[model samples]
Target: MSVPESEELCLDVSGGRSGQGPATWGQQAIWDAVSVLGDDAPRYNVSVGFELPAGRPRAAVLEALTRAARLHESLRTRLLPDGAGGLTQVLDAAGRFPVTVRGCEREDTERAGGQLLGELAALPFDCAGQWPLRIGLVEADGLVRYYAMALSHTAADGGGLRRLARDVVMLLDGVSPERLRELFPATQPLDQAAYQHSERGRKRDAASRKYWCAKLSEGPRGLFPPRGERVRDALFPNAVLHSPALLRAVDHVAAVRGVSGSSVLLAAAARQISLLGRAPEQLLQVVVNNRFLPGMSQTITTLAQEGLFHLRTVDEDFGDLVRRVHMSALGAYRYASYDKRLLDRDIEELRGRLPDLADHSCFFNDTREPELFRPPAGDTEVPPLERAAELTTLAWPVEFPPRKNLSFAMDVVDAPGALELAMTADSALIPRQDMESFLRGIEDAVVGDALATGCV
Candidate 1:
């Protein structure tokens, strides 16, 4: 495959106003869209890619990108205010723009990712005219091509990425766009946001808040150096270096122990913290989505909340802690609708919190994508994907480097499961090995967290 000196990639934004300007979509609608995602809105991006037949045409690729953007009502959206206080995405009377394609260095895709992630970290976003996602076509020999797609986390999620890939394939094959639809569109994000505020939701919310309010007060326990450091530089893990046996152990333990892969992950993190913090009082914050609003299962918005666990790292059973962590996750998932911004009193305010909280650990579960969304192998036939051009997933930025004092962000991607741990810390205060040891502890906890608890 000849890497092109210049590549033509497209960026098409579905949710903003144009020529007729705000006439197409109102500000109220746009705000509502953003409001629904809460803090998760800014971090959202859906990406997927596929290979075309031996002789797939480049023109076909272009058409696929254009057609799919035109087809989805979501792509034609604008984040506007709902007038009362929240935000909603107003669909343009006409929902899409002809795809916008540009030519840049093959390296452009890489730089774009770094910059986009930084933007997500540095700014609180507004969706008007925002290009939340982008598409790239890379040459895969004369007749074959590959697609990479990237998006703003505010708009679509990993599941949405799967839909985008499937749709692009359908459109390229000449499927009519109108009849095209998501497998579970009713579970769209907007509907979920409404459920969060519903009466039934309130009951769930009360219980979750009480649990975390107590958990958040406890100190962190991990392999964190006294000066603190970021998770990425510390872990130095890009690919899985551990044995398959270890990864298999992670999965098997999660299942036998009645936990999600993420719960297992947090447990691992706790174990590492216990060793690193050196004291039993160390703390970390986990981010959980409140997206279970009844019907909105497939929506791409971020409905999230935080959970802080006071880990019994020194002498407790791993099984018990895993159960406690699992239960805490359930509670948080149920009530994440109540963003701290809306807490009943003064201390509950997000603004009132520390300016430095960004330095703490915030765990997110993208779920191992394929495992989270699919059924048993024979459950359903996944059709061959289509798109006019190759897609690219590197458009979004990576992240902003952390200041002194460290933090970690965990992401699960396509490769065999491995942690994409990111961190920020005072370089002068902590060395890199401290971070690696902390990450190893997280890995070790999956097997021995119970041992740590027993010692306590």
Candidate 2:
């Protein structure tokens, strides 16, 4: 897994200025997680590759990256640890952005390139020591064939990474930063930090605490039995259920029920957990992206927060529970954004009052289509040469980090022509066979709902 010294090129980014600010709430949550995990945790490293069209020059690739580093403050912001146990984001405007140009042998370029991406994906971030962005260029025959960038999640979320890629391509096409700033004005991460400390933000935090306190008061402690030991891994081993039929069924059911696809999917998953785990009540930690707020949609930072969703005392009938799950999911999304540190404190008090609250570690996240994948606005002036070249992101496989006290986590994303559900769980608690059966039950429940609702 070692990269050879001879095949690498390093360049120090120059002419950038420097500034300082506090980390945003989203950044703080990521910082805290990384601090706990230390340097070995790759839980937050996001790596995305772009296939270089044949006509594009290698110089444009490098220039675009350097420009990106200079233009995007989040990529250059470094977290400095305080003696009193806090983190401050230091933005090096003129700091050198490192670009690693790795040349692959012509014969082994394709295979080695894939391996290289996975290796980069597994590398941890040093938030307190260096810039949060790492760029890797794959070269063959003196031309840049493919390029990949790995970013710390503290600076960007899944959506932000995609946006970053789009901007890079736009820059490669010779779009001026002024034009970009006008067309897609980004809300700087620092601004978000300021808002998190504002009086309004404090009020929002209080509202979140009240919502969660009441939500946890009625739920059973947890969905899974006590394992008695905390797992040190950032994520557990998991399996995926990808089905075009399932996706169609979910959409059909949602249409008939006048609900979102996410609601239908959530209902199906909760139903499966109730049947398989034999827990009449299920507590799900649902992840929601808080970018829907004004002036924050284009912000390139981590804005994802978790909201607790409790499915309790449901009647055995599956159809009735779907309505309940949908309503609960709506309520959960409403209270998803909040100060994590404050929310954590409230959770502790709630757990004390309701001891079973300790067992509610299961999570669900429905990542709908990312807006970053959309085509850049056509109205913006751009060169025909850059327009001729097709640019898109390449997906890379990344391992999930282990979760402490997490029995299972279910993630659903909309694939091209299907819905994909990836469930990661602790094998010691929910065995492989049982989880597989749970997946089957989800499909069955979804299909049954679609049929019963006249969606067949």
Candidate 3:
């Protein structure tokens, strides 16, 4: 990958009205961390790349991007600390979204483009200094071959990224600008914040608070104990355990137990953690896509939040355990959307009632997609996806706020044929061997149960 001389074009987009407002639940959660870590925490920054169809008009491509920036208010938004030591989202109604046109030789475009996409994704966002989005166009042989966009996680989430891709394709398909707005409109973060503060939103928050207080009243148990030598430099190692048989087993068990695949997987994970930690109870936070609200499904904004689920049981049947985990996840998902600051206050209040209440930061995130990305079929001559012009997501290690012990995250990616269960652990905590055992145990919990139930 090489970087040659590049020309910059700042395209000013219009439509959004300059305004200031409170952040959304997801954004607020990220802000809470940014307040302490600043630019060190890059987990909230997201990037995506798309291969443009070959022979497309360059002017049309540029126009589509300009319209996209205007369509999504979040792309034009930036956050600043309020006078009272909090964060406020400022929407730049008229913002100049720069698109750097970089030309790579046809032969080197593939390698250079991939490297550029990664570097763009890794670029840190200056929360207080700039807008939450970045756009780039990779061209070769006088034709644009690739387009990349990086947005702060505060602006959009995994689901929101897909929505952005869909909208851009629609624009390129020659949809009327006005009709496109009506079809795929941006839901400003301010509107989401207003809803969060509404009476209905308040009611839901109260319910969520009550549920969490009850769950954490007994205090958080240490799920993974640090042992042996620690890495001199703070680093985390992630390992993925993939198996087709285990995937089938998970589906079979879920079918037999009348639960979703997620429920079964969660149950298996909880069971494995309990056995590995050698504790009756295990504390694990589940990342939920808090998009249950009306219009939020298509509304591109930060909507991912953490849901706490504690699994404490001994000698329970796998099926019954799955049912219990399923019910717990239901509550967690329902209460996932809430102001992080208020939620922290509630946790502190609970401390008085339950003296043993402690915090456990280890979590589980299921980022599986039902189906992979399918390019939009259109009349335009879309370029073939080659080594140079490919579409994919980049995952990098995330840095958390200071004063961190061992933080583990179990991420699951579902594919058409198998399930990829990845266990990521801070090197200071469990050794490589233990992490491997925990992952294998999770696989066994599902496959073993399926075989026992004759469902496999």
Error of 1 at 347 (Å): 3.9
Comparing 1 with 3 on TM-score, the higher-scoring candidate is 3
lDDT of 3 by residue, 65-175 (tens): 788777777788888877775678888878676576778877666665666677667777776788777777778888877777887777788878877877887888887
Model 1 lDDT vs. the true structure?
0.47
Provide the lowest-lDDT 10-residue window in model 2. Answer: 387-396
Q: On residues 1-456, what C-alpha lDDT tens digit does candidate 1 reach at each position?
A: 333353443444342233222211112323344566666654434445443434356677766766665554455455554466645555553433222232234434444334333432434544566434555554433432455566544455455556666677767777766556445453433334445456865566566666555444443433345464334443322212232223444566677777876777666656555655555443555655433555445444444445554444433677776777676556545544453433434234422563222224434443444454432333333221121001211112233434323344445433332223343333333345664555455555653442333311
lDDT of 2 by residue, 1-456 (tens): 566443445556665567677778888888888777776668668777755656356778878878877667788788887777567888775555456666766665565566667666788877888878777777777777777888888988877787788788899889977788888787777777778779987788788778888767766765665433545554456778765556567767777777777777788788777766678787788887777777777667788888888777665776677677888887877788787877888888777876665356788887764334522333534322222112212221344566676778888866654566788887667776777777767777777676666653
Q: Which stretches of candidate 1 lie over 4 Å from their true place?
A: 1-50, 53-72, 80-88, 95-126, 139-144, 166-182, 193-214, 217-245, 281-283, 289-293, 310-320, 343-367, 370-400, 403-407, 412-430, 445-456
Model 3 misplacement above 4 A: 53-55, 105-109, 176-186, 225-234, 242-258, 314-317, 352-355, 371-407, 414-418, 426-429, 447-456
Q: After best superposition, candidate 1 residue 414: deviation in angstroms?
A: 4.6
Q: Provide the overall lDDT of each model, using Cα atoms, as 2-decimal numbers.
A: 0.47, 0.72, 0.72
Q: What's model 2's overall lDDT?
A: 0.72
